[model samples]
Target chain A: MHKDRLVAVAFTLWAVLVTGAFLQANGAYLFGKLLERLGR
Target chain B: MLAFAVTAALILALAGLGRPLAWRLGTCRNGQHLTEAELWALAPLLGALPLAVLVQVVGAWRYDPLSMAVTLAVALLPALAFLRLRPFVPVLPWWPWGWMLAVLVGLMAVSALAPPLDHDSIRYHLTLPRRDLELGRIGLWFGWSIYEFFPPLTALLTRLAYALGGAAAAQMLNVFWVVMAALWAGLLARRLGLGPQGAMAAALLFVSQRVVLNLGAAVTTDIPLAAFIGAFAAVAVAGTEGARRALLLGLLLGAAMATKYQGIVAAVAMMTPLAVLALLRRRGLPALILAGSVALLVLSPILLRNFWITGNPVFPTAHPLFGADNLDIFAPFTQAMAARSVVPGGLAALPWTMFILQDAFDGLQFGFPILLLGLPFAFFRHQGGRALCLVGIVIYTLVWWGAMPHLLRFLQPIFVPLAALAAAGLVEVAVVGRRIGWFRPVFAASVGVAIGIQALFAGSSALYRLPVALGLADIRSALEVPAFQYYGLITPCLWLQDNLRPGERYVAVINDPSVYCPQAPTLHPLGAGEAARFYSRGGLPALSAAQVAEMLRGGNVRYVLVANNPGTDDETYAFAKHRFDAVLLPILRQQKPLVDSASGKIYDALAVLAALESGIGAAEPASGR
Candidate 1:
């Protein structure tokens, strides 16, 4: 159980990091509409 | 050639971009080198995706903004990841990915050489793609038009194929899904308590069969539907907390739902397991959150689309809880048609023996008879497994009851779990073989024979082709490759681009316009039985038989290709015969034949366009003038 939780935490952190990077780089293209609205 | 070149470049570029990310993911998961088995398991799945560059590139010919974006994401991400992962792993298994790839590529080649055999796809799937290529935009869809409402995921791939691979790009797309399905099956097997080898065996068994042959190599929705549903199920199982996984599950579920209405059932079915876990497990709040969030998230986009178009979130099926009727008297009444309905005599009307035999135990032309073998054992073994199997059976029973005289496509979701259960049974057999020394040889021989029988059946059906053996000899023939041809949604669209003329308008009278014209000149989907919208005001619905005849008289409709063949009343055939002669005779006579096969026929571009534009009345004068 402890190992599984640790694995889950690691997976989550990795998912967030990768997703964040993708959002930052390609964010302009992928989420342009939402971002523009947010800026407003 | 031009389209194929461009598509290849785009795929390579996107793959390049994704490699870093894919590598990052792999590194994060296990780090450094991969085991022989992991390499083997991973190889086939990755190689199977990002399939023929021609298919994806061909879609650019039409350039649907929405579909293009999604394709770029799916294609590039995986391609890049594979490239990155390969370099990181030093030693890999010879038998794992290597053999799997050999068989898969072989199947693809063989199926390509075989004739297109999807009954409905040829009737309309290829028909639409052919039209899309010929026509720049699709106008309207009607008459056996249920196909139009399907999600754009597969069509986008087909459009890419049409852009890159010319007409046969759908074949490449099929190879892609065959890989996706295999990967998902492997994942599902792991979840069901199978080793890597066992999972591979199950994946190969499911992918390299006759039933898979029909959908995997052709442009059909069944395999994609199955893939999405199974993926959703896997995700649902993976989620530890109810809330966390539920949210993810919802998104996946929604994506599946958007793919097809049948996915709604699959989404619900998948949720049932999570719900059970929530009830049984201590972390009920998290489970509930996960399940509910996922369901809502996944269902929202389609629900919103439905609500926006049909004035009800469910659309075309049921009225919204707080909404008024979305129809008026003038529109065609489409309310009573059910997605699943009961016909009198049901299975009795079908060839009961053949149906039972095929459903219970499919051989070469189909999958192994897992349901019969697994259900009995499931009852005696794991309670949870038995419960899951029962739920699946109930769902299938309801679906079958409602969808009497249904096609094989309708049974996909049920099959996913059935395959898992069957894999469990096979694992048991392997264990039993290990226990008894003498039985080991017999078991191995039996497995060999079973595989041989399946291969022979699959080969005889011309569903797919097997690869050349690694060793050249009569005995080594067992190592033949497996080729696939089904492209899920892309098949019809690819056919359209290859056969049809560029810059023509082919009106598809269906909600899912991709069914007829993947890249039509003027695509006007009738969302949520919005038939009246087309009929009202300046919509294409005004282009009725009389209107079409008038357009033909004006030399507007040069060619008319209707895919509502064989299945419908003789009225449609009679309608085409009378109208084409009375209205489009001159144009038909003058126009070049676009496509003529067992599927349908296409005609000259100018004639059909002219007929559509000028109305049927100006047949001689409009052209001459």
Candidate 2:
């Protein structure tokens, strides 16, 4: 149970960081559209 | 409070209006069953709607817009980053424990030496922060501020290393909290049995720009409370065998409750979910044990302390419970509830809309846009996760809407669980990647890249923005600015130990009172006078003018600081001009200018006091205590 839990946690950390990295590389355009609304 | 009203109205409107649009556009869908990673990543933005509404309402009432704006901006920026990342990717690479340990250590190190920019730290948060930095134990009668009388669990642990070793030894306390927060986030993820991807996503959300930048480094009670809340939630999720965990969880929950009053809300929210589950499972004994232990462990001390202090278990808060006369806590609530007949000005409406826009995209300052995504997901049946997340959101939203004192730090406890669910929802959506071929992958990749970029920029901007805004260009320039000096003088607080003689006290009679120059006398209680009181706790009473006049007929205040541009209604100026002319400042000679602004000058008060002490005045006054 403990090992399984650890595995889950380990995977989650990786997924989050990878997701963050992906967002860093490619998600800026969509996010930028959101930011443009701020000019109002 | 008109600001609060329009804000609350707008929030209800936005949530009502936007969720459907977001869903219809498929913006609500992120992936699949939330990984532990995603849960941790997205927990902070739970209270976005309520907070944005509250800020707008507060803004509408004509409170200082800049600080309000700054607070909202700071809090929402992280939410935006997360929201941007939600669609395309939801998780990261899972490192081994060894790698995680090293990374945690590095993050912790960065947290400590980073210049303490959190204003509340020196004022209240770090009165305990600094005290914990020095003495590991929560000392008694810490006269710094009344706010320091919070749950000392976090303070005790943070200061323990410093106290056992030496002063400045526990500079790594911030690092400890950062690591602990990450560790706890991991624990929470594991407890939820999230997949590798889910857990990583959760972890990222937890360490997202919002959590790390805002709560990690700042020595405040918020992170600790959030930590305990997560711990309690984790234990409560451990199932039938976890009945044993109840008492322990109760203790931590109690400690969480003690950290801040909002901890009470979290405790209730967490426990309620557990109780309902136990009931549904027909585990009567475990349910009883859990409920009883929690009440006994948590409520007993709180009730005892409350009764001891204010004759009620909840001595401080009187509204909706037995009414208490403490206006400080309840006044904002009452004022916000009271409807003003006059319409708020047009300028007021401007910020109202701006905060709404900011909060929608930015998560009200921490930048967790994923929160905007998560609320729709709350309608789905993940039972445990959904229930917990909903409870947290409701509590946070209610608190924000009902009583907005306009302090973001107050809302810290609400963020943890909210972030958890938002991350979960994001991951849940990301899991849909298998269905939509090109669309899924494209969306997932774009989101991940977007959030990552936004986080980098947001973090950099947030890190640099305050210092730049405060005009902290250089050491000399910083010191020359009173505001900058206030932030820069953490080390100077330690300097008083070596610089001053044991018996001699320095009194600065500055017309303008500042946080940096706390040894000065003025109407603003938190100024220099409060600092002197903190240093001289239980030792010497620095004589206010009325008190000084009764003793020595007008001598012995030893020093006076006369600052330029000490604005109108400066109590010191009035005293100097009218009442104190005869007794004080007999030899008022100018010294080197302290601040660069037109309103800056340092005066030598010892010489003046010395002359006064030597029979320069006729009034033979009695000595005062």
Candidate 3:
């Protein structure tokens, strides 16, 4: 992979880890509420 | 409506008062003035200094409306004379403005218009100010709360707002600090040689954060401390030279320290690098000294007051060093907080834990990820202010981790520098995107989505409370809802306000939420360290029913408020059950409570005492009702 592409891939993985962790820990409840409200 | 209006007026007044001082200090040695963004950012903070000082001075005399109005008039006369109006212009792009407006409106609807419901706000932030106003002086509320010994700057400011309008206005004042912090973050970004776009990104990122949105518009020291810390960073990083810069830096440092104890950690973190850098240059030594001196001068009032009362410059912290008595009464509470550290893997696991297990650390999650994502990128490029911000963040995080990493809220100051560095990182990512076509859209989409998620959360939270803010629903009725019923003392306080006669006092036991009962005089017997002095002996449970009754009678307490359910599993309850409940429960059974709800039960002190004397209901078990 090109250096820039490698950097991009690593950054994408880090973002996923962070976002996933957030959702699992705290954001899931709020997000669930948001989704439920939208469903209603 | 009146609260919003009063808050707006106070913001303008503070800006007016601070403008002259900010201008004088904002001028660079080369004769160029700081950008308007920088000047305006510094204005409210600079303006708040004199007002805070005035509050302390007037507090010695009395905190009545007459005294407050007279002092304010005297101070504002000069401020009004120096006030200069400038045409309002929007410097940032429309997108940043839209996000800021949405956040601001949401905060106003959710927090500013509603009665204070946050634990710390009711416990001390608004409570202490209300207590001082009621007492007609700012004397030592020694047994009332340990927070009385904390820095009084924000409390002083809150008192001013509370005096002017009410608790709602005091709550609304925090909105000003939020905006000021955002603006200061933008100023710091600009100082870092990040272009206007980067500045907007920094500011928007800051305001849209979960922590900022959650704590915004509540009467808390966190936002004000962040604002002052941001202002300090912005000024410290400016290319200004000599005494003027020193003076401005000192004032800001002092303000930060005066806002909260964590301010001391922030100052040490940021200033250590600046001092070392200055020493390396040799010529900057005198300027550093001048700044240090000014900071001490600004912090002296709080120091002197604490030393005078408790023989400790920073009371409740360094108790053994200063021989500050009675603080040991709170050791169990403090120890419980220490034991509650949820960062499982310690220092090595901090970064992951801070970002991932935020609930364990007792904070909302969105802010840390962007910081984690962007800060590393900030170091890749040779940005002007990047080195300073990076060092500050590193030192601050390390110190915070060592001291109290469990409390994510204490890390509020680091957000100022972290936001700047993260914005730089985002800018760097954009630079990379220029070479790769697909990367550009991805970058935009990511940033947009992150900010959108934050705004959505903030807007929804605000929507829940929109009826109260819009005056469509009564605040009391709203507070009675199950969500707020646990900590919201409004319902019980309303009952007390109606029932308690003049010259009557209520003793609150294991209930710290009596702050809402400003109309009635209330005392925290267990909270005030009196339990340690009178009830406990030989580290064993020695409390008796007669002793508790006598303490109440001696204090002229007519009512007794006991926590039936403290909402959370509190150490105080655990400790009290062993030592206090056995004695008090028997007495409480004798009297029909004046008010009983989920929050607590309030009993007639006279009836309880009569029952105690008559030996009625003596066989009631130690188990609490």
Candidate 2 Cα misplacement greater than 4 A, ranges: A1-40, B1-108, B128-138, B142-144, B164-171, B191-193, B240-243, B276-364, B374-383, B404-408, B461-499, B508-546, B549-557, B560-602, B607-625
Docking class of 1: incorrect
Ten-residue stretch with the least lDDT total in model 3 chain A: A1-10
Could you give the fnat of all candidates in order?
A: 0.00, 0.00, 0.41
Candidate 3 colliding pairs: none
Candidates, ranked, DockQ: 3, 2, 1
- lDDT digits (tens) for residues A1-40 of candidate 1: 3433433344334334433442343345424534543463
The alpha-carbon lDDT assigned to residue B426 of candidate 3 equals 78
* Clash counts for the predictions, in order: 96, 104, 0
Residue B265, model 3: Cα distance from true site in angstroms: 0.8
Per-residue lDDT over B1-625 for candidate 1, one digit per residue giving the tens place of the 0 to 100 score? 3433444544454345433433332232222232343333333222222332323353534444345445555555545545545454433233753485457545664454333444455455555655555444332233223244344445545555554454345555565556656666666666666667756665665575557755665666566666666655544444434333444445456556655567777666656655666677655556456556655665575567555554546543433242443332212222222223333345554322222234322211343333333233333235354355457546654655453234444666555565656566656555655555555564455455445544544554342222221122221121111111111223333455565555444433212223334443433323345453432233333234445544434433333443323223221211111222333444455655565433344555455656445653455576588
User: What is the DockQ for all candidates, taken in turn?
Assistant: 0.01, 0.03, 0.45
How would you encode candidate 3's per-residue C-alpha lDDT over B351-442 as one tens digit per residue?
A: 77886777667656454366676767776667657898778878998988776535787788877877877887877777777787777777
**CA lDDT, candidate 3, residue B101:** 50
Worst 10 residues of 1 chain B by lDDT: B478-487
